[model samples]
Target: MATRPSSLESGRIHHQLGKPRGLLVSPICTSRKMSSKGPCRRGHSSSDSPCVENATLVPTSVRTHSENSSLIASSIGATEVVSQQPISSNVENLAVSRMEAIGQSLSARGISQQVSSVILSSWRHGTNAQFNSAWNRWSRWCVQRQVDPVRAPLADILEFLHILFQQGLQYRTINVYRSAISSAHVPVEGAPVGQHSLVSRFFKGIFNIRPPQPKYCTTWDTGKVLRYILSLPRNRELSLRLMTLKTAMLVALVTAGRCSSLIALDLQFMQKTKTAFVFTLVKPTKCSAASKTAKKVTLTHYPPDSKLCVVKALEVYLQRTKPARGQGKDKLTSLFLSFVKPVHAVVSATIARWLRTIMASSGIDVSHYRAHSTRGAATSAAARAGVSTAQILKAADWSSESTFTRFYRRDVTTSEFQTAVLASVKR
Candidate 1:
């Protein structure tokens, strides 16, 4: 009983006020997948057609539902306006468009995880922190090994650990790798894979996998180190070399400086007043810790280099050799080469090779000794020099190990602990 715009009644319009009737005339509304570009304005559409940003914004208040057909109609420009759609299809398209917009706002940035963490931490502090350079190296390593650090799996890393062990890497080194990936994800129940971190999840029982301990190093005693040096093949300049080796070994054994610091030795650090060398054991400008303060930032561990053995040996080495270049660097320094390639600067490998040569010469059998053996030797010697294990721990900067006490135990003297038996005979 209700109708509008019929050919049978040219001049009259019919309206049944409350009757449900079958008079249908509505434009079909359709649902289209959202374009990758974005939602379009009223004049524009959610079609693949490009959105014109210059177009006026649509007032979002306008909308209507159709009862006659699957098309929604509303009044615009004082005339009937209709939307094309299958009703469900139109709703689906709107849902997808809104979803995509939300996602782009929440997805991960391309920055590395470490870098992102640094940024977040820095922001909390209201200043930027230096990003770690080690991450770059590790990332390059991952790429070379065909592992995606962003998505590194536990299996890939387990195999990587095996490779490291096979390549003569010590447990300490492998442990460093474990630390690189040590961070675990805080899992949320039923969360998406990429949505949450996988770090903590990957190593669910990682602690159960005991990192291989390095060879228990009880063999780097002074006698062993000395014996190794002496076993090296004797040359015509055997006396000179023996003196040098003994002195170097003595300093290394006493000081335990890092390779860089040991190689970086100079007369400037020699404190004649204190009768010791003030060795700055810290690596130069290589760590973020350098910002702490000048002397406080640098690690200075003094070894008794003033002893006649160290001094005389150094004096001899200085007097005997002249460098082909690097005169400026070497002019006032005679402790270690100040420059190389026409000057003198001692190198890490050279130290290692010399130790190897001396070890071969000295006929010592120290399996767990390398360049770091000097550190072991110095700690051991300190233990024997009447220093308490606690004091040695501080002196050696070795608070990190469970075995530092073990390493620093000198022989316990029973006689030193003996008490007099003055009152025991009366009974």
Candidate 2:
């Protein structure tokens, strides 16, 4: 509009607005009488006020006739009366479009598909659940101790690990907590707090104090296990359930695959040959995530008369169960399912439960044997049968012999060659 008075234009304009305590002064209407610094009567200007020399005192109702005239004029100078109008819709839309274009260009400029995938994976919920859990535990611990959790000192992390160790947590388990906390703290701090040199040395000391013990497991008798499976009750209600368990246990033993890999299997991954069905593990597994290509395991069928044939068990189970079938993969269909209502994909825990059921039925202590024991048992049996190390390693999907020899290849029956010779001579 009109030129704003230097005194009234500034933020300190209450004095120019009659110093009203409860009223909001309108910015327009310069014809209204201007108040001076001294006490003055209404509709009058003091001799000291600039309005006394340049502006005429008018009634409160007096208004400018021109619709486009300035609402207010300066009392000190003949300031131009600039007209005020609402901004055009076109101008607002153009401004918004320009801002959106700039934002889109900036967002798309440096982001490639690979970079976007990596960024998304970094913050993805599935990958960071462990981190979140670990952080929450540490935060609660910090709260109990009346210490800051997020900016925890390196010493606090070492103490936390020490506490976990004292609670009988394995070295690897303590390290998992450390890794999770360190990863979460990296965004707030430039570096991981637990990875500090002093903290690492503390970890080394802790490890030396309480080294992790190798977990012990008992192997299963493949022939006896098969016989047990076949002898299970074949009543209408239990036949399908036993058959599915038999097929699952046999396939797991034959392939020497982990529960994760077993539950992830689908019909699309299997190719039938003359004597065997080859299963390709194209999906990422715990061990194969870093590998470039998928792995394959072949399960050959036994003779038609043999009751322990994995192929036969699979065929019987497939025939009994009603999996959704189509040309391509049916996402709703899984290799394994619960016999209960609303059949759905079996998780790794389900496989573990099935293995426990099988183990418990065979007079073996189920607590001492886990589902992963299948891999060890199969590899050890192959080794005992004069199978090559490389063949066993390949079948077990092991990249090296250390894990096979140290962990899987346990001498449950024989301690040494002399004991074995004595036993053989006595027999």
Candidate 3:
């Protein structure tokens, strides 16, 4: 009689046969025949037994340890085998289960499960984090008050918004919480929680009391930053740290891109031309995700200023970091890698910190302005340089001219009105 192979031996056999690690093969169960009732027999649940009809191979990684153990036990009396199912169907089923779980947690009953899943799928990871945070806060409040958060009365929601306002939360933050509640709760009196009459009135009152304000009224001078960058040692002479900073700041200024876009720049999608370096963002940016369009950032050679040219700085930096990409299978292909050992791709937050470092080194007040101010500073400088509004809009990826005018446009120079008034009334 032939002896049965252990699980380890089966794994070795599969490996020797060049089978993919993702695929798992198990011997068929021939100890018991299928009963007349169903595919599974008595004393063996369907989930616990591998019947002839359900003996198809699935990825071991997707199954729990106990399930795999059961499969190994059932394969002890084996003869025939079955082919594998496509992995795509299992992955799809996993995604559907997750969506259903989300729908149940959110108490999303106003829409069908399918529609709710699709709606939830549209939210980005960052949006999900924000929504979850807000929901957790709401849930805590309901627990303290002994009310159901998902089915809470309008009075409870209004009281919660009132408490948030009293806590000195800004209108924008409170509005986010309101939107989060609306997402989880069913409509109240035929209107979303945010749009209900009393809730709308309360929000309007809050807005009137504490209006939203632009973060920066005037942006730092771009020439100051460029001059500082140019004053640094030559690209080849500078240390890897300085070169990385210089390259990042130059790209940030010329492209007027957000940190998200900067970090999403992959070498695989980059195109170098005689006049410019063109990067098509393979990943979706905040604006691109909303507009359903791809974003392209082009950095053209600056002939007038060789030292401050983004293209030259980027080329030198890339060459400097080439050896740092690692050897063998561990090599990295990201546009920006960490300067430290075991270097890997940098995150968006790291790029933001690099921008802030450049700003501080260039004499800009880092306390008053955030890393995001780079967008406003660069765009405002372009507008001052007589660049057309259309070009500015296109470069900044803004869908409307009003977006630039309302949010990003700022005085890059000293306030002319204040200077004129002070000069006329000399002390």
Tell me the tens digit of each residue's lDDT in model 1 across 342-393: 4455565566555655555554443435555555555544544445556555
lDDT of 2 at 406: 69
Give the runs in model 1 whose Cα sits over 4 Å from its true position: 1-174, 178-204, 224-244, 273-276, 280-288, 291-308, 322-326, 329-335, 338-343, 366-368, 400-403, 406-427
Please state the error at residue 246 of candidate 3 in Å. Answer: 1.2
- Candidate 3, poorest ten consecutive residues by summed lDDT: 6-15
- Residues 1-427 of candidate 3 have per-residue lDDT tens digits of 1111111000000101121112111111111322344322223222321111101011122332233222212211110012322222222121112233357654434566767668787766545555555565564344333344566789878977776676455676667668767776667898878789998899899989988666577777665566676678788899999899888987877777888889889877899988678888878666766546577778777665567777898899889988888666777777999999768899877998999999999788888777888888777767765567777777778889988887788875465335434644663
| TM-score, cand. 1 | 0.46
Off-target runs (Cα >4 Å) in candidate 3 are: 1-101, 105-121, 326-331, 413-427
TM-score of 2: 0.64
Whole-model lDDT for model 2 versus the true structure? Answer: 0.51
lDDT of 3: 0.62
Q: Write down the lDDT of every candidate, Cα atoms only.
A: 0.35, 0.51, 0.62
